[model samples]
Target: MTKNISPPEALIYAMVTVSAADRAITTDELNRIGSIVRELPPFRAYTDDWLADAAQDCGKLLRKPHGVENVLDLVKATLTPELYETAYVLCAEVAASDLAVHHEEEKFLALLASNLEMDDLVCAALRRAARARHHQL
Candidate 1:
């Protein structure tokens, strides 16, 4: 098992995983992650420097055996049940920030939803919100 991580760190891992799901993390995605960390209420106590560190730590952990599963388990363990939806929404935001959700990103979201025991209807609503927020005319 990975070391016990803070809730903020767990959320960061979720975003990073979603960002990297497509194997090509885009500039838009990176900006979205940064913005989420800087603006989100959950991350209010988290510093900008810690954002980079947490993302790096998540990446290194992901290089290990069964990394994705391990990270998901860590996130599920670290966050309170109440924050599961928050975690999912944050990830969905990142995945949709570039105005496109790739196949890999969709897969990651499904895995995250399963790991967090999120309701399918809630996930659908969150995904729709993310898409609507990121949509441009």
Candidate 2:
């Protein structure tokens, strides 16, 4: 049976997926995810263990066969079409948080775009914005 996830949970999965894309979840990426949850309007209602719990659930899903595909499918189903770009942007934010987008992360980003049916130009713009935001001083 397919599992159902809330929009907020879907968003967290998106971030978590990107963070784990490189096979390691860095401190910087975790911190970025926390800040995004704490500051984003969609996550305003999420508090305390909500983030951790959602991340853990996502991790579980990631461990199963075809886990990544399951996650992308779940996320695509949970969120509305308008939120697809936001989901992509959130993933980009996490991927770029550590200041380096690994090869796996790049592949995941492309997959995310394709799964969500996001426009190429829009994905490019969001990716550029993520890189710019994380640019070092």
Please give, for residues 10-60, the per-residue lDDT of candidate 1 as tens digits. 999999999998889999999999998888888999888999999999999
| TM-scores for every candidate against the unseen true structure | 0.98, 0.98
Instruction: After the best TM-score superposition of candidate 1, give how far the Cα of residue 18 lies from its true spot, in angstroms.
Output: 0.7
Expressed as tens digits, the lDDT of each residue in 2-64 for candidate 2 is 589999999999899989989999999999999999999999998959999999999999999
Residue 114 displacement in candidate 2 (angstroms): 0.3
lDDT of 1: 0.94
What is candidate 2's CA lDDT for residue 99? 94
Candidate 2 similarity to native, TM-score? 0.98
Q: How many clashing residue pairs, candidate 1?
A: 0
The CA lDDT at 114 in model 1 is: 99
